[model samples]
Target chain A: MNVIEARHLWKEYGDNVVLENVSLAVKAGEFITVVGTSGCGKTTFLKLLLGVETATRGDLLLDGKPLPDEPNADRGIVFQRYSVFPHLNVLENVMLGAELAASPFWGRTFGKRRRAIREQAVAMLESVGLGTALLKYPSELSGGMQQRLALAQALIKKPRILLLDEPFGALDPGIRADMHQLILSIWRQTGLTIFMITHDLKEGFYLGTRLWVFDKRRHDPQAPNRFGATITYDIPLGHTDRTTLHTIQQSLGANHD
Target chain B: MKRLINQRPSRAAQVLLGILPFALLLLAYLWASELRLAANPNDKLLPAFSSIGEAIWSMAFEADKRSGNYLLWVDTLASLQRLGLGVLLSALMGLVIGVANGAVPLFRAGLSPLVMALSLIPPMAILPVLFIVFGLGEVSKVALITIGIAPFLIRDMQQRVLELPEEQLIKAQTLGASSWQLILRVILPQVLPRLLDAVRLSLGSAWLFLIAAEAIAATEGLGYRIFLVRRYLSMDVILPYVLWITLLAFLTDYLLRVLTRRSFPWYYNGGKP
Candidate 1:
């Protein structure tokens, strides 16, 4: 069964439309990445999925239930700009989710609950290669490390699903590639489902099992007709092997047809 | 980053720096005894640094024959009582009002302008009005300090709390942190350092106001002592008292800086943004 399913999802901003008639589904533990140009409403889609924003119309389902209106520990999010709390040390940032997430037994308890969860945070940080840097502040670290911390913050809670909004889009090419690989490794180890949004097709091809493309029709008649904002294609997990990669590369060289 | 340029020198260096100016003054005062002997070195008028120290050692510290140790003790107790009451009342009232105004949009819009105006008007300017309402009693001085300082603390608390990042708030709420939990764990921790600074700032300002406060219609206070000496044209007493006040202010500011550093180390060391 699909872990996440959306039917005729519509997101509108005043008069302009961001995403319309966007429907998609993902199997459990699938690594899906949504790719599009700058204004493609990809970020909006991720926000909607993470419950940071609401859909204008249509139904959003999470494991067959109605989408929650706000964020939940069941789904963790990482943003392009690192969301690592600048005031909290790495360990605290990671454990904060669990402490505040309200486990049945941990409720009505404070410091005692955190002590146990802190060990979990350290192990998770160790998994992310941040064992030595767990006490360091985000400002003291480099950008790539901060992203790693953000990833660690999201992962430590052991959320069943993770949502990333261009987590590597802001990094340099080398770091971005490293982050992509690290994310893949973590997903494999933790078996957490991921849905990432990015504009880089190469990244989408490399890391994503499933991919969606957003396009917007231009207002200028003189220019090629394309979406100013809309999703154009949604491709499957096995859709991108060597030949499909070549096809996307060739298609890029040929120009928008 | 690039070596912080010793913004705060070591404690020894600070002590050395503080004493150096006095040393120079002492040398000058002693040198004047040779050829430039200012006619009368103990001229109750100019009370040199050494004389002021001697005078302070005589008056503020000396036994009060009339009030029996009672004069000094009573002044100290009275000042402490007024200060403690005013600060406590202001902190409690300030945090509540500040949090309310900061958190609520309508209240912030409607009342912030008034708070801003209150903060701008000098408390000394209206000292006479306060005296008229509360009279020259302990109530007048404490009330004056409370109203005079609470707005700034309230505004500081309000702005700092309000400025807490929306992303963190949303993150906490998503984690199921109730409103009270959010304030205790998230908002208060973030706002506290700034709140402490505001309190200290208001306290120092109130200390200055205290002297002006006690200068009128009262029998005893640090300020009253200073005012009484001024009436007698006794620079010996006035000079020493002024030095005491200066030293007190310096020590208080230093203590506050150290306390803040110790309490809110998170503030000094960068943490989760």
Candidate 2:
């Protein structure tokens, strides 16, 4: 069975249809990267997968079962900003997931359980190159470091699906390069099904095993919101050529214009 | 060569500038009092600085012959206790209701408008009602203070919680946080420092309500003493009591500021976390 399967998914906010007829089957361990124009509903699709937004109409199945209406431990998401808890330190941020799971009411664990959570959080942070910065708050870290902390915080829960909403779009190029390498290594080791949305086409191409382009196949100039966006391209990576990339880029630019 | 907007005084200059107005006011008062005294040795309107000094010394240090209690200390303790209890209760209610109304949609829809309406109602207008309901005692006084400022604190805390990024809540939910857990781990921690801020802002009004309540009904509070001496035209006692109240309010605000900075450093430092 596929890890995720969406059949004719449609999301509309009142009359404004955001996503329409988005159908796809994602196998486990597939790193799917989504790219689109600013209002092309890529983020909406990601929200649906994370279960933050429900589909207006369609069948979204997880492991051959209906997707949960709300977010849960099965899915983990890291947004571009405000992803990490501002009040928690680095280690505490990572430990929060386990703590909430263990002591649902108090959101904390004491004694041996807490020590175990600390060790696990430390190891997760160490994997993300934040071992030395465990005591630092998210505000004290640089943008790159904060995103690293966010990633560690998300991954600490051991979710089956990892979702990234333009996680590196705000970082400097040099730092983004390092983040790319780190994320790739983590993905390879975990074999987690990852869905990442990126504005940077090159970054998307570099990190994804599969690439999806969200664009409206039908446009109505008289009624702009008449048609919603759909997956116009679902290209399997590893065989992507320069001409195809240039063609897609030109089309996207034309759509923007 | 810097423009006025760009110019900033040095630390010592800043201190001097801050004290300049108070110094000028004191000098003017002293000169006026001296002139009034030269004209009439028994002038009661503007008491001489020495008389005010003596009043402070006597009230604060010397035990009263009738009660054997230092009037200043007794009044200070009574006022502080009422203000402390009222503000503590207000903070607790504000945090719980604010978090509930801000975070939970059902609670927000049901209670936000009610809280909004309550905040709009003048807390002073209901002072008489409170007196009738709770009797003319410490309960009425403390209840007045709590009712006066709690609505504002609740509104402030709710606004702060609402202003928090939606992504944080979503991220917390994805991390397996239940509704209660989300409030405990995510919303409560973030709102606590902000709650301190709201309480600090509301302290001025809290003091106002406390004084008003005490002036009307209490027998031993600072406000009661001030109003009591007004009949005798005791400007000396009134002035010192007013100054002491101002000092206490300033110290409370300063201590709350320091506590917020020390306890939640991230709250003041850009709030990026």
Candidate 3:
């Protein structure tokens, strides 16, 4: 079944149409990475999927139903920055989703239940290689560690779909590669649907089972925003290996630049 | 990251750097007092340090014959009570009004402009109005301080709440946080440090209002004593009271800074809100 389906989605802010006629049917457990030029509405598409913003027109469905009007547990997202709660430590950050889901209004659950949640959070942190830093604040973590915390914070909620908007865009190349591997492994283990947007052509090709390119095919100088970006290219990477796709796309993307 | 170039001063130098100006000012005052005393056997304007010390000792230790209370301690307690009550009330009101103004458009539309106008009105200008409404008692004084400071605090808190990154709020909602849950767990914790910082910033104005109200009308308070001594040209008492107020304000600010650093280390260290 398609976990997320967008049919002729349209988003506009005032006169600026961001995404127009964008359509997709994303299956469960698929790693879909999107690459686009800056201001090509890639992030806007993610926001639509995350339901932070409603579409100006068209329909987006999650599980073949209308997309949620606002953000909900069905979808989780990690931004490039400020994703984790800085007030909470590593463990508390991961545990917040459960706590909010359970005893959201007041004091946290006590006794065995609280301990059980803590253990679960610790295990989640351990899986993200952040078990040792459970007591540390987000500020104390390095750039890489903080992003890992962001991942753990999102993953702990067990959302059906995870949306990432350039989660590792700020990291160095080495750390970004490591995060790429970590995310791929998590996707494999959990069989979770993943949608990510990146400016790096190579990273996009290396990770996703399918690739989407968003761009405006026609631009009018008199009315530059007359056409919004759409999924101009949707390529399935089932047979192409990462290296081969990267090499070919590197040249193609270089030209598209 | 670029290496931090400047080296910290040695411990001894740091201490000396802090004390040198204060020591110089004290020496200057002592020298001026000596010249005055030589010119006149008893000059009330700049009484000898010993005379100020003696006045403090008497007021602090000796019971007043009329009131049967140690005037200095009584004044300190009264002043502290008024200041504490006013500030506490302002903080609570600010949190509520500010959060509402920030999080709810209806609340913001109804209250924000009015708050801005109230903040612009000089707090001292409303002293008579407060006195007329609440009468010449502790209520009037506390009300004066609260009204004088609360508006500013509210605006500070409102701006802080509004400035919170949009991503954090969205992320919380996605985690299945209800609107109230998002506020209590996410917004409140982040805005708390900013609240304390605002209180620290507003302390000066709070003290200003407290003293203005007390000086105008009060039976016993630090400001009352200072103003009362002015009639008899008792600089000895007045100087000591002024120093005491400064010391109290400094200590409060220092304590708040330490508390913010200790309890919300991420706030200062991360520089995020």
Candidate 4:
């Protein structure tokens, strides 16, 4: 069964339409990569799926049920900047999910439950290779470590659908490659449906089982606001290799990076 | 000694540099006082330092003949009480209004402009209104300070909360946090440091309002004592009171800085994780 189903989704802010007629079905365990130019509504689409934003038209269904109005534990997102709470340490950050679930307010879990939650958080931090930095604050970590902390924070909640908005966009190429490998392995082990948006076509093609390209195809320069970005290309990358995608990119002859 | 521009000096040198201006000011004041006192042994505008010292000893240590109260201590306690109450109430109001302004669009739209407009009004100008409404009591003075400083504090807190990245809020919500949970866990903790910062900044104005309120109508306060002594030109007593108030203000600021630093080390670390 498809974990996510968006049927002709439309998003508009006042008269300016940001996204129009974006429809896609995302099955469980599929790594979906969305690649488009800046201002092509990729992030907006992710926001829509995460329920940070509402569609102006059409429906989005999760497991054949209507998506919730607000964000929930079932869907998690990691931004490029890594949205780890600055006030929390590595352990507290990873434990935040269970803490929030156990006690929504004050973030205080006490007694045996607290001990259990701490153990879970500690295990999660260990899994992310942040065991030594357990007491360290986010500012004490490097960019790659911070992103790992962010991933641990999201994954600790055991989300069914994980969304990444260029989570590796800020890392060095080598670190980004390492993160790509880690994320792919995690995806394999967890079998969570992942939707990622990126500007780097190579990175997108390298990781995704399915690729989506967003663009405003019917753009009139005089009144460009009239047209909204739509998913122009949907390519299933399960069989097609990177070389084939690169050739297709050359044929397009545009800045697909 | 060679002085390097922009380079930090040694600890002793830094202390010397900090005290240099104060030393010069004191030297100038003493020189003028000596000249005046030499000419006329009873100049009251700037009394000799010895007389001022004597006044401090007596006012701070000894009880008043008529009222049987150590005037300086009494005044300090009264003024500190008023200032503390005012600031505490202002902080509470600012946190609530500011968070509401940041989190709720309806609340922000309705009240933000009103707060901005209220903040623009000279707080001193409405002193009479507060006195009339609250009466010439501690409530009036405390209320005056609260009204004077709370709006600016609220605005500052609102801006800080608003500037928080949208992703943090969304991420918290996705982690199964409700609106209340998001605020209590996410927004409150982050904005708290900024609130402390804003409070420290607003304290200067709070002191201004407090002194103004007390000076205009009070039987016993630092401001009242200062103004009361001004009539007799008792610079000896007045000068010490002014210094004490300044010392108190400085101590409050320093304590708040230390508290924020100790309580939220992550806040001071620029929120890296």
Q: Tell me the whole-model lDDT of each prediction, alpha carbons only.
A: 0.75, 0.92, 0.89, 0.88
Candidate 2 lDDT over residue span A134-184, tens digit each: 998899999999999989989988998999999999999999999999989
Q: Is the docking of candidate 2 incorrect, acceptable, medium or high quality?
A: high
Task: Please say which candidate is ahead in TM-score: 1 or 2.
Answer: 2
lDDT by residue for model 3 (A1-257), tens = 88899888999999999999888899999999998888889988998888878999999999999988899989988999989888888999998999887796763577888888899999999999998999998888888999999899999999999999999999999999899889989998999999999988778876889988888877777887888998877888767666766555654465346
DockQ per candidate, 2 decimals: 0.34, 0.85, 0.65, 0.71
Among these predictions, the greatest TM-score belongs to: 2
Query: Per-residue lDDT of B125-240 in model 2, one digit per residue for the tens?
Result: 99999989999989998899899988888888888889999899899998899999998888998999999989999999999999999888888999999999999999989998
Which predicted model would earn the best DockQ? 2
Q: Each candidate's iRMS in angstroms?
A: 3.6, 0.9, 1.7, 1.6
**Per-residue lDDT over B104-193 for candidate 1, one digit per residue giving the tens place of the 0 to 100 score:** 678889989999999898888888889999888988888878878898898888988777767666666555566666665667666767
For each candidate, what is chain B's TM-score? 0.81, 0.97, 0.94, 0.96
Q: Chain B of model 1: TM-score?
A: 0.81
Off by over 4 Å in 3: A241-257, B1-11
**Candidate 4: regions farther than 4 A off:** A14-17, A104-106, A238-243, A251-257, B1-13
Native contacts, share recovered per candidate: 0.37, 0.86, 0.70, 0.82
What value does the lDDT take at residue A10 in candidate 1? Answer: 85
